[model samples]
Target: MDHNDLSARELAARIRRGELRASTVIRDTLDRIARVNPQINAIVQDCGADAMAEAEALDRRIADGQQVGVLAGVPVTTKVVSDQKGYATTNGTRLFQDVIAPQDNPFLRHMRQKDAIVVGRTNTPAFSYRWFTTNAMHGETKNPHNPALTAGGSSGGAAAAAATGLGHIAHGTDIAGSIRYPAYACGIHGLRPTSGRVPQFNHSGPDRGIGPQIMAVSGPLARRVDDLRLGLEAMAGYAPDDPWTAPVPLIGPTFRRRVALVKRPGGIDTDPRILDDLDRAAALFRAAGWEVEEPTELPDLREAVQLQIDLWLSDGHEAKLAQAEQEGDAGAIALLRHYADRAAAIDVARFGEIFARRSALIRAWRGFLEDYPVVLMPVSGELPFQQDEDLRGGDVLTRLWEVQLPQIAIPLLALPGLSVASGVVDGIPSGVQLVAPPWREDICLEAGELLERGFGFPALLPR
Candidate 1:
């Protein structure tokens, strides 16, 4: 049987029914990773030996008539940015390669509690600061669809691993477009759950600044929409470590299937292919009995994007900027310098003002989403760019940021966004981004499932 082709949902069901053993799945997953990871460079740290031991224990528990959790024995990979007990939370830098985590982060603990076996740790850019996944410590992560194109950062490794079947699900974090863009580039499904939906805290690292505490979130990336849903089910819960985490239910009240299709939110220039994909996805929703409309009445996304940047660097990102320089990753250096240039101009008063205005922006988006339960926009205004395109110059970085307004804007509002790969265009993956009101990940996932069934996008495995 092709174990690599099975979704986490399917794999877990089969395991529970005794048609497959936990050890079999672990071995198959590790073997597949060994065969493919060399070219992709996705799984930077393989935990196969420990994973096999855990899987064997799970099998023994099953044989002893013990009831396991929903994700029983499913192979998973956690991004290197997160704390996984005993592994280095490298965050893709040579400086911290030996910074071993004393305990698992809340999300990792949750996954293990549900019986998900962590097979490996994926890579990321230094400090997870770049949109393209490459760093001095872990090297570059290549897109499974096209090696020349970016795998997408900072969760590029997670997306690449999931797309190539290294694991059934990959854990990812997003403060900007990290999770969404990687999934779009690698041709998979990734969900950036509403802030506080999933508990997150890194005991090994310093406490996050206000921007990340509110905007950054942990989510799941997978090939199947149902698998994303299952992942959220296991991941969403309160943790004492994260004060921001709220006790919200995993599923929200159902709303009318009304979607607002924004061809170009904030009037940014979108590539022709992305617009075509949006139209195609809108048609699918219309055919699926959804009320779809192209509405010009939308929130000021550009303002939100700028504010998010300011807040991210408001705490005088000099320390991180210094660290980026020390790490000597060209991409990270460029990104930090770009933001530092802007940060230098802003004073404490202006930073305070920007933080204060975040509430109003959230209100504006909430009101807009009330009329339209879902908003379908570009995951990126353009398709995946050549790897390290941002390292070209400041002008290229500016253009890249403009094209990524769809991704950067959502984080400021602390809302949930899902990237669903529609199809391949011009030898690269293309997809649409879905946003809903806070705690409305269920709506995004449901809409994604509809688009998934209509498009029937084929999975892109490594050649």
Candidate 2:
């Protein structure tokens, strides 16, 4: 079998058993990226020499019989928004094109500590906004399944790269379906670890505002459920620099393998195909002995989604507009105009009210979560839409928000969401998401595993 096509679990096993060397694996990965990335536009920046050197070091450690960490030699991509020492943390903006970091973000440091090789950086929308990955600086990232459709953003590059086997696991950040939606779009799996489950700190940038500090989180997008678990284990921890960082157990005793089926969180209708996939996923879980219940109603998800916009728009509007203006990119300017009017009236008091209500909502969600281990829901209201189709007018923004309702809502609860590819719907990839209580990603993975098995493990793109 081609080493590049192996799951992270299989590749790691081979590397540890000395059946393959890290250098060989990385070389194959680079070659795969070269062949497939052009079509997908998934990997935006290459860190070739750095990746090779890291792999060689891992090979040497293996030869010396040293203790190698779990992901030793696995090739991975970092999202542009995350900081990696000595690399430009572009954050998908020309404004920060020269922004270099002297130290790694906590997640990157942790990945390196686990001996994972940094292969490249993935793309995002400008300022990591929007549900599609496109920017004047990095360009659009096409879906591996169908180039016509969107590869959901802001982690679209990561999801595309992972789907195409450019890397076994791609690092991603989630603020509103940035992680899970992309995974669904690209026909793969993504995990949005509960806020602070993963230690995160960026030494190169100013402290983010409360909105981002609460809603944004770093996570992983990968080809398999096991890889997601491995990636989360390597990244989750407590960092003194991120005050919200929490120490969560990497593994805990198994809980009741029960999941709540939320056909549409907040009564919003889901695409028939997406609804079918969710039903199929639920049946798969049932066959696996997991009790699945169709919860009559979900939490006040619409309220949570709206509050997310309020928090994000409060103080972020001017900052985002100024950054876009600085970039002077047509696409950025267009997006700024789309959001500017909606955010025009936000004030300090309104922002504070949103924050206060957010806390209350989180508390309420936590209480509801205590009853259900996992909530299986649609990753998006529909599958990946035509790329740039939404750019046609103002109504598209509402459509984008409607389709991305779940992504926006989950973050407000400060919980984790996992998108597992169930199967393809009419040649386009379709997936279901599993939402777990804050800090309990195990439930998400448990549900993800069942879905993967039922789906028959679809092949990597363009093999």
Candidate 3:
């Protein structure tokens, strides 16, 4: 089998059983990235020498009869926003090009300790502020399936890289739709583990504001459901740096396969094709001895979604506006300008009120989840958009908002959601989002596996 296409679990098992060497796997992955990265612009900075040295060390350890972690010898990619020792943490911004880190962020360090080989850093928009990955720094990352459509942003490079077999898995962070949207666009699986289920911190800079502190989370994207589990287990290791990092097991003993499916939650205009895909997945699950309940609506979704927007942009409003002015990137400027009209007018008292309401919304969602272990919904309202499309335009933003329904609501309640690729419509990937109560990533994983099996896994593009 091609090493690049092997799931993370498969790669680790082969290495552990002496069927493959760490060096061979890492080298093959590096070669794969070199072959395809020029077209997709997925991997930004290569760490060839360091990755090879790490693989060599792992080979010696195995020879010495040492026990390695679950991800041992698996090649992985990290988002540019995450800190990796000896590399500059660009976060896809020119303002911080020289901001090199002396230590690894907790998530990267945990993955490294699991013996996962780091091949390179993936691209992101400047400050990871956009949903489509493009900026003045790393340039634009194209979708692997269709270069004319978006790869999905923030973690766009991660998704494209994983989709094209550049790496076994790629680390991704989600504030809004970063991880899930990219996974949907790339025809892969990505998890947004419950807030702080994975430890995350960038010691090189001051702590981020409340909006990001509450919503931004680091997780994984991979080509296979099994690989998603492997990536999450390694990334979820506990650390004290992030106060929100819950020290909990992401997976637990098996449970019933019952799920809740919502077609148009909160009156969002879901595309007809996507609704058909959701119904098809429900039928597949029903045949697999799982009960699928069609729910008309979810509690507090509209209010929670509004709260998410308010909380997310709370602190960065002015700074981003000024930066947008300086960069003169039309897309960034337009987005910031639109938000500025409202954000700049809010008083500190009103901001506090939003938080108070946020608490209430979280409570309501928690109550709702008690009866539904897994809620199935659309990943995006419609199909992927054209390349370089400006999402900030009035109608465009409305569509973007509707398509990102789940992304908009989950953060307010601090829940975990995963995007499992279902099928493709017109060559564009379509996916279903699985959401669960806070700290119940196991539910997401279980449903994701069922979906992956029901619809046979999609093949990667040939190198």
Candidate 4:
């Protein structure tokens, strides 16, 4: 059997049933990475020796009649931006390549406790500041389906690695669209759980600013909806280190399976293919006994997206821009400068007011979500951008941001957003976004499963 083709949950079930050895799965995973990683540069740091040892130890424990965790024997990759004891949490920057983490982030520790083997560390853009993944430190991650298209930044390496079978699951952190966009671009599944649903803490780095503290979250990217569900189950929990971690149940109460389909939130001009994919996804949900609503009233997505960027840049935009300049990442520099230039006029009082008004926006969104448990929207206005499309010019960046309204807006509302790969359009992968109210990831996953079944999950690999 091709072990590499099996989902993480399936592989773990096989390992637990004694049909496959953990070591064998790990070795196969390592071999797959060795063969494919060079082409995509998804995994920036390989952990073959440690992974092999852990797998062999797991095998011994199983033979001794010990009970392993749910993710037993599954190989996974963690984004380099997170703390993973013994590896440098470089955040894809040359300035901190030597900043070795003294301890694992709470989420990584949780994954380890669940017996998920860390096979490698995936790459990210420098400081993880852009929508395109490239840096002077770890280089760029390419789309598995097409090299000319972006892999989707920040978590691009994780999405690419999962898409190509280098890992059964890839750990990713999202503040904006870091996790979801990559999944859409790479033809995989990524979940940006509601803030605080998954515990997170990076001891190796400085404390995060207010924006990230409230919006950023760590979740999983995988090839199947079932794997995403399993991964979230394993990662969800409270950590003493992360004050933001909420003690919420992974499973929430059942909701009426009604969906609100917003083809273009905020009147942004979306590519025809993106709208087609959304229509196709809505049809699938409707056929599967779901009540689909169109022309639904949604909150101001443009305001939310702009507020998110303002919050993200409010604390220290100039400092970040200067750092990006020093790092020599043209993309990051341009993005920061663009934001700084646009936000230059906002005084401190206005910034405070904008942050204070976030609660009102959340309240409005929650009320809308009360009637429709799931909201299906375009993951991006356009399909995956050509590699480095953000660097082309200011007009391109504006267009990119406009289409990414859904992605940026969800984080501000602290809602769970799921990116499900519907199918391939033309030569590129296309998909839709599923969002639910806070702590209601179950709703998104349930709807995602129906879409997966109706549209069928496509196994994407780089040519």
Candidate 5:
């Protein structure tokens, strides 16, 4: 039936109306994964047998006229970093390769509660640190569109799975630009909801540190913004284990359909092609009755990036460096070396100052959002890099890190950022990032839909 080509929402609706059986859909999904996963290395842990059993059970429930979940019959892939029950939460590192999970984190728990079948677990870089996905344990996840380009990291596998139709919607976590960049690289959509918008906790590991508490969040990746919205609704809810979680409403106060456009964050220019997409995106907004404004000045993203680094490294980098050494993962070691000097100087006092300064930064962005509900910007200053671009250390790696300030800065402000895939530019996938005030993901998704109107979702790979 070519069910893989439909959106998660559409598939779920079909399941609800008895037009499709959950077991048949999941079996087809597993078959597709078997055929395509080897080429991309996206799904590292196949949960095919378990997913099929669950699907069969769901089919029975539906036959009995039982009410199903919002994501019924939808096949999705979970990021390996999260503790999916009974699976190894490897985080793409050898250190935790044998540590089995005891229970599902908020993500998979919610996904299961909503009857979404997880066909496999996706890969990530060691420590979920690199912008490119690879590890000694699971190997590298390549872009489904172009193997030469990277599958954006941390959540790269999730994006690739969605881009290739291996999964209709994918579970993705974003602390920096993990979800957004991967979505851009693979020609899909991902949302980095405001911190705590989606509850998270790892029973397989220790409690989350302060920095992650303030910045890290789990969100969704999909080909359709509508599916992304459905993913969010199903995954968001209070989980007792996470102290940071709350019963925040999915929809927020309405605002003017206005957008603040940023071509260059911190005065750094983007690729010419990205600039053109930004132009086309703005025109689409205007045509859709949105007022687009190029603000004379915007929040200081460079400073935000600086503070984000300090807070992120507050737990000290030496321990991580030692772990990276033990894992013998080149990319992880390279990342640690690149930030050694900066992370070395951060301590208790610096962390204190970060929070004090963070308040003002958040206030500034909140004020700006009050004026303009959404910000239209590039997901990355550069296009998807050649695969393993970070492997070439020294100046090349440093430049790669600096170029992603647009992505690095958002997590610091605790705002919702949406990555909307525009189209393929000269064979590489290109996209824009939409930022909304904290807890206002609705605004970002609404803005993304408008930009998507101009350059519809890219066709799935392997055509």
Candidate 6:
């Protein structure tokens, strides 16, 4: 059987039924990665030996009448920035390449506890600060569908891996659009759960500063939405190490089936093709017996986006800029400089301003969600841009972030957002973004399933 073609759900079910040995599935997954990874540069660090050993161990355990995990025999890749025991949490830079992790982070620990084999570690941008993925360490990851366009940054490798069947599910992190944009760029689905949904901690480094503590989170990327659900359930287990997360259940109570559809988020000059994608998604919801409406305006997304950029500067950009300069990666330097300029200044009062505004914005957005439980919008203002588009600087960088407004704004609200592939558009892959109330990832997934069926995207896109 082509194990690479099976969704995590289907593969795990088959394995749990003793239809396939864990070792066989893992060997096939490694073979798939060896054949496809070079073209996309997705999985930066291969764990083939470790994977085989674990797979064999799992097989032995099953034969000995051990309990089966929900993700038995499933293959997944964690982002390089995340801790996976004995691997370097490179985070796309060589500065800390020697800083090997002694223990797995909360998410990785949880995945292993559920018998999900880690086949490799995916790439990320140098500082994981940009929407385009490229770095001096792991090199650039290309879009598997069209190398000319971006594979999506930070979590680009994760998305590319999912798109090309390198792994059944790809683990990703989202502070901005790291998870969603890559999924959109590579024609896959990525879920950015609520801030506290999945435990977040990296013992290999100092604890996260203010900005990341609040917005940054771990999530799942997969070719199938059901695989995403499996990945999430495996990852969302409680880790006492991370104070942000709790013992929350994956399923949440149902809310009204009403959705608000916005053509342009944060007043972006959305492309006509993107507008068409939104219409297509809306039609799917309507077909699913859900109410879809186009509101005159929602909360001030533009302002929230600005605040997100500001939050990134909580520690100030000087040190970050210096690090990027040291790394000397063109893309990292360019992005760090680009956004740092926007957030540069001297102000102790900025912290006060940030929180007060954050509170007010949260209230506004949460109240808005009270009326519309879900919001369907474009993943970006335009289709995935040409690879290294942001490196062009000036108008290109400006335009890139303008369309990324939806992605950059969502994190500030601390809600669950899902990116569901809408199939390739005009030779470039594009998709729709779904937002639900905090801790209500189930709602987004429910709606994503309807959109997924309507779009008819296969579990894996053609590479």
Best by lDDT: 1
Q: Who is ahead in lDDT, 2 or 6?
A: 6
Those runs of model 5 whose alpha carbons end farther than 4 Å from true positions after fitting are none
Q: Roughly what TM-score does model 2 have, to 2 decimal places?
A: 0.96
| Candidate 2 lDDT | 0.84
Q: Each candidate's lDDT (Cα)?
A: 0.90, 0.84, 0.84, 0.89, 0.89, 0.87
lDDT of 5 by residue, 324-437 (tens): 999999988988887888887887787788899999999999999999998999888999999888888688987887789889999999999999998986779998899999
Alpha-carbon TM-score of each model against the true structure: 0.98, 0.96, 0.97, 0.98, 0.98, 0.97
lDDT of 1 by residue, 1-463 (tens): 8776777888998897788999999998899999999999999998999999999999998988899989998999999999998999999999999989999999889889999999999999988988788887888899989999999989999999999889888999999989999999999989999999999998898898888898999999998999999999888899999999988987878698899999988888998988888999999998888999988578789899999998775466888788888888888778878887788888878877887788899998899999999999999988899999998999999999999999999999999999999887667898999999999999999999999987775574863
How many steric overlaps does candidate 5 have? Answer: 0
Which sections of candidate 2 miss by over 4 Å? Answer: 330-335
Tens digits of per-residue lDDT for model 4, 13-41 = 88988889999999988998988999999
lDDT of 6 by residue, 1-463 (tens): 6876677888888888889999999998898888889888999999999999999999988988889899998988999999888999999999989989989998888889899999999999998987788888989898888889889987999999988888889999999989999999898999999998899798899988788999999999998888888899999967898988877788878699999999888778888878888999998888889999998979888888888888864365788889889988887677677766565663669778988999999999999999999999888898888888888976787788787899999898898999998888556887889999888899999888888889975546444
* Residue 421 displacement in candidate 3 (angstroms): 0.4
Estimate, for each residue in 155-248, the C-alpha lDDT of model 2 and write its tens digit: 9999999888888889999988899988988888999999888878778899998888988999999888889999998887887878998777
